[model samples]
Target: MFGGGGGGGRKPLDYEELNENVKKVQYAVRGELYLRASELQKEGKKIIFTNVGNPHALGQKPLTFPRQVVALCQAPFLLDDPNVGLIFPADAIARAKHYLAMAPGGLGAYSDSRGIPGIRKEVAEFIERRDGYPSDPELIYLTDGASKGVMQMLNTIIRNERDGILVPVPQYPLYSAAISLFGGSLVPYYLEEEANWGLDFVNLRQTVASARSKGITVRAMVIINPGNPTGQCLSEGNIKELLKFCFHENLVLLADEVYQQNIYQDERPFISARKVLFDMGPPMSREVQLVSFHTVSKGYWGECGQRGGYFEMTNLPPKTVDEIYKVASIALSPNVPGQIFMGLMVNPPKPGDISYLKFSAESKSILESLRRRARLMTDGFNSCRNVVCNFTEGAMYSFPQIRLPPKAIDAAKRAGKAADVFYCLKLLEATGISTVPGSGFGQKEGVFHLRTTILPAEEDMPAIMTSFKKFNDTFMDQYDGYSRIIQYYITPSVKT
Candidate 1:
């Protein structure tokens, strides 16, 4: 006897075909790092997180005015309460009204596709003062953070299969991920590691030419000043030459200046590409289109959770500017609180303001501490026998070139792994220090390196370094076979 429903007519759903685009992308490193960290936690190990540049996780605190503004913005009704006003700084209240007035739709309503005009104007002023050039407010588009601005810029230019973007081989993975996710070709250029991780113009020319020859329309070149994972800040001459190259090649310039405030060396002050472009005078034509990005996530703020940032597109055609706005419009607007935070960030307390003295002192103290941390970490790394670290001239990372023993290299090969990655994994296992391998950021074919944040608390750094050195020596001794192979690989490649 057949049941009431004799047969089922429905077919199984194929979830595989639902997201073919997502399937094409792989963020394996991040996933693996997370999984490994979780496993170690379960084992009751103390894990040192250095894989990402997050300061708050490392004990760096935020400043006053910004947080106060955040509290007000989060609870707007506070604006009406006299008690609330007393609790809040007068400057904070004034700033809120200024933001509301400048807000495209008065903070209560939706803003323009670009952003609130007043904030943009403040951003413009900030740019002018920082870059030493005149900036147009209309060209600025505030976003959730530099990441959104970057993705939008990438989306705007990456039209079809033929379009491509030139990015440094050892780059912030965001560029590679965005280009791939958007279905655009990625043209890789090598950074000269031997010469302090400098940009190689020859490699840039060769990469662009190769892409163009292959029918790929090279659209833009990305320059991460105070580079991520590498920590090399470009010189003024380098910036000028790069700008010239961009103009000659007819490519849009994408300057990731998020770490603009993190420079440690006096020689390498964060030089604005806007300044370089404008300073070139009439021959430079001011016609070269450029997009400069900034974020509150870096510098002294460390408000990564807030995700407040903006990007300015200078010297672009009016039509292109509108197109960018249209794209941003689709996302409605960045978080409202984030927008207010960004406004305060760019136009922070000035002298004579009630909170100026306290705010300025607190901000400077935070920066001073970071400076100390950077120096301490760099000095400690350099003291190790087998690790060679570049100066932490700018940015908060120290990318050290580690000399692995022959045994370790052989063990890694036997286990079928990149030597640096193998070393990092073992380091993580032995001690809870988490770091990203150079391979993840694209190193030279044979050289092995690792990127670690110099952000652990100052007092704990010495102990961390000691633990790292001990682990390296033990790992090398344990893997003698791998060390031999690594030596052979390096011998021929070694210069001098």
Candidate 2:
């Protein structure tokens, strides 16, 4: 009854014709608001992209030593130039020569699918140093960025539609998007907002049981340490508990530790899950499979454009690792420059090296500025009428919870938008500050929040805070009696 080209006209591919799993995905970091921001910018509007953790776009400078080394590597002939010493440090020149020797056919050529062997060795050393445990260069699959490695791992893990990955509520949407794209069900476990977005095992257990009841086979769990969006650093005790839970449940652990170097608090230090698991020793370490991801895009490096990152696999079967390698080979190799950056990231200028002083200064300045901006933004959000923000102890974002009035909720419902989306859009219109809605990252049914990067330059924070407060105050005032109710609910009256 159906004709190829005779039924009026052939439809190219509507929503119904596309892959259902692909259609289910949504990435709000560069979603509608960002597009609109771009348009406004073209029309002469000054837009600050707060939706994503892109430090260089916000004026954070890249470090000198890494750039110099990469530059020389890209063009080795520069080393032969008489003025090379004036432009690059002696150590940087030596480093470039060292890496160039490691490269198979220079920067223009494709590398081994697993990555340049020498770089992988450096990554292993970096990990060994960080975790105080041995790491295998063989297990490292260098990709375009941490994202590629994450997607590959998920693709390898997800069997079918019934397979699921336990993702954190208010998680980075990459996990959800990757799960959807790979045809895996996302089982969300809500992080405790009252306890500064800490992981609650009770909630986790409930989520797993619920998914199981619904006939969903949870294969793995994704934990974002020094979390994305919510920005909570998991404690060592919590990490141990998570490992135990995964071990007992026969689940793999996917640790998104890209923000490992972004910790701002003295009290909460970043601990690799590998370190914790190995510390547990014996059967626990042997039994649990972990894939931890890291990137140069976040932290002080902020080399997002370079797209350099790596993921290390621990306790995965050799066959499975081989399969991952096969999948990686399908793409030939990740960009050689990115691979080079990954190598340089793990092994930067050391003590007494020619570039060490400048490297240290550049790195420190960027990190300290981020800390200051985070505190300023957190304070600004807390000062708002119906807003409550947890401290950004780690990571580059502040996920602030906003209490919207019934009227605003109804308006959002009418407009067919999430409550936080409505608020964020209005904020964008009033002031050119673009942020992602909490619903973009999963959240509870009635809760409303927004994720804004604490990444605007330190000097610009005061102006951003002023504009942010002004907009929120005016917006809250429009919705009558909302602030009073939130204040009452949050701080219950003491009846003497």
Candidate 3:
């Protein structure tokens, strides 16, 4: 033993030595339940993961053209193989070669700290096509995923515990996790679930004022347009109002628009915060800083493993942008294949191009499947006793509110668990259905909900729904003693 001088008897790193901020972080999507599920899977149980918006995990196939190009780039020698044309289309081969030229040394090499300039340009072009406005490639940062960019932005904004972010209740846990990790406060604003999960400005104002009253300096607000957990897209009018709120309050707007291409409702099409801000012109555009995040993970591409995403900074100070780049530099570069994937995602084949037909067909098929799954899951959940789910207008989740029996709540308490977590664990155990509890995402006190992705294959949904309904019914039956109490609370008897 070296005593206090060296290694022999020194204690290993543990919770006490960990960062306090790290200790506060809890991401329930892959928390205890998911870990248990994984353990069960290793034991050969067929667990269906509905906990996260991971499409490919649920059998969503990647698009042909992107994969082909990626494959060719990964093995550029494939282009020289005489059978290349036999396996890959002409356009894919050409695209791969093009990206190779763009990359400093193809997939093996690191790109510019910001990203490949050409790829960023393509991203900018994609934005211009989407918004009818110009985008600067220089303002873009290629990230491992949209989440990295979001966390980086939070890092720049949060200086201490006094700093807070205005985060929506029933939001994706990423925002909350990042705020915790950054040692910042999450000033909660409850979204109106009764009103199709609408953002109530009155609630926002009150939340901001209350946080301010408590000396929490609210510096940023996050909007997951085509929302996560709650899959309702923001109307243009609503977006305009939100922009106004940010402008008046001097809060930065963080737009999570990764689901921009996942819109299913014709009436509720996706709109970028940048587009709205620019349309408002000058003061609105100049004053309010907006950072919008997009990814190749959630769209029809469903290339979650690629880890490709970008965040465009609007109205941010040039100096701040430089800081972001400097931070990115420490990471060396975003994944090169991911950067190429981003390019493919933003600039798919044109109509006249050879791969156009296949690309369009593949993209359309995936979108249609997702739309069908969303509708099917929403209907099934709404039909369940004491459960209400709004139809998903966009994004890939159905966050259904469950009315837990008081008996069930008591049972959960006895188990030292939240009621929704108790319900989700039961569902998982009974039917191999994994889900994230609303407590993890934040919900009104006394309200119980669970978020399930609509990413399961269409063919598998009917059986999944049947299993879910049966488990729910059986669980409710077990808690029948509290059913009458819930009924009484909702509808009191009138004495004549």
Candidate 4:
């Protein structure tokens, strides 16, 4: 009675009337994981979050000096009070002032479009030390995070019509999202999982040729060293080969080295792309335009909330450098505190300093714990029946291949879901553990996988592992036919 047939003329909003590419993209894992967790919470269920690489959320604390420096910079007045003198470090105070003096608008206001000169200089020094090569401050630009810088670079190179970027399959989503949003073609090359997630030069050449045949100009090749999700670190030999390939192909090389400090294996040390370029010498060094990105979000700091990062370009043309600066200028400046935070990350306390020993030990312990956790998760997954997981040599995720049964696949399809996604959803429902599916990161057509972070508390990890194993066993039992199909594909048959 309140609303009759002709009550009021109101039309519904058609939110779907937007970009076709955006419509095609899906970020279902995160949303489903969170939603399911919330639902479980309603029933008073305790959920274990393995879907995101957030250390702080799992009770990992930040280093004292870094946090103190940030807080002092954020509010200088607190430092002036006499009672607070004992609470802050004298060296930290001096560092804060130095940062403020170097910051544009004196840390209270916005900075230049590129970033503060002081921080850029510090970044250059850090690069020089790390790469054992000369670096220019002018070539560096501080960003809110590496994600923004990558997107900016993509925007400049990808000029509509025929532009494309070569991204590894099972890549970080940021690359795909940016390319899709900018209407640039995404030419994906597969990483060989059978070979420890190695870069397949044959696949690379084939993908590039195919893209060119389709009239798409492959402008750049994006490499996530210490590969995301898969967690494979590139060797020096591999780096040399990749650099040579990029040089020969005239491809702009984008090296994502945010996880430079997260290497757990002793044999595979983190190698800088710029270092590889310089060591190669001659035309390879001069010909390849490499932009290496670093961030405080990963590694020991794990300061994802800070959004502090930088990109250093080696052998870039002066004109291109200016173009990058001009584009970055639109942002006016990176966040002032974030710039200061980046400075601290690059140039931490020296060995002779008062806090140096403690700081060093604490940082090392955090990294060691992360390494142990990575091993625990990978080992646990491998122990489960029908689950195969490679060692996480570096990076924060364990991407495991799960053998699903026919019924599970059918059920997923019936529910309009990805097979791994269905598997993960059931995993969350049964065990309160959430993870992202491999399809979200672009895996092979028929294979199903899921990515779980190794950032949960060490004490709680075993329980998480047990839950995962139990759920996987239950799922396999329920969907034996799907399991058979997966087993048939993965295991070779023996002929009598």
Ranking by lDDT: 3, 2, 4, 1
TM-score of 1: 0.91
Clashing pairs in 4: 405-482, 405-483, 406-481, 406-482
> For candidate 4, lDDT tens digit of each residue in 1-496?
5644563544333455566766655554466766788788789988877777777877788988888888878887877789666888777888877886776356679887788888899999999898888889888999998888898888888998589899988988788878887888889998877677898898789899999999999989999988988899999998999998898888999999999999999999999888988998997888899888998888889898888899988788899888888888888888877778899999999988877887899899899999999989988988887777788999989998887766788999999988988988889888888788888888887788899888998888898899888888888888873433334223232110
Model 3: CA > 4 A from native: 1-3, 6-12, 481-496
Shift in Å, residue 46, candidate 4: 2.7
**Which lDDT values do the candidates have, in the order given?**
0.80, 0.89, 0.89, 0.84
Query: In angstroms, how far off is 34's CA in candidate 4?
Result: 3.9
Residue 55 CA displacement from its true place in model 2, Å: 0.7
How many residue pairs clash in model 3? 0
The collision pairs in model 2 are none
What range of 10 consecutive residues in model 3 has the weakest lDDT sum?
487-496
Q: Model 4, stretches more than 4 Å misplaced?
A: 1-16, 19-25, 28-31, 38-44, 104-106, 481-496
User: What tens-digit string does per-residue lDDT give for candidate 3 at 1-496?
Assistant: 5546755553556666778899899998889789978988998999999998888888988899999999999999889999999999999999999999998588998899999999999999999999999999999889998998899999999999999999988889998999999999999898887678897898789899999999999999999989998999999999999999999999999999999999999989999999999999988988999999999998898888999999999998888888888888999999999989999999999999999998999999999988999999988986777776788999999988788888999999999998998998898888888889999999988988999999988999999999999988889889983442342112122110
- Hey, what RMSD does candidate 1 come out at? 4.0
Model 4 scores a C-alpha lDDT of 0.84
Q: What is the TM-score of candidate 2?
A: 0.96
lDDT assessment of candidate 2? 0.89
Error of 3 at 469 (Å): 0.8
Residue 258 deviation, candidate 2, in Å?
0.2
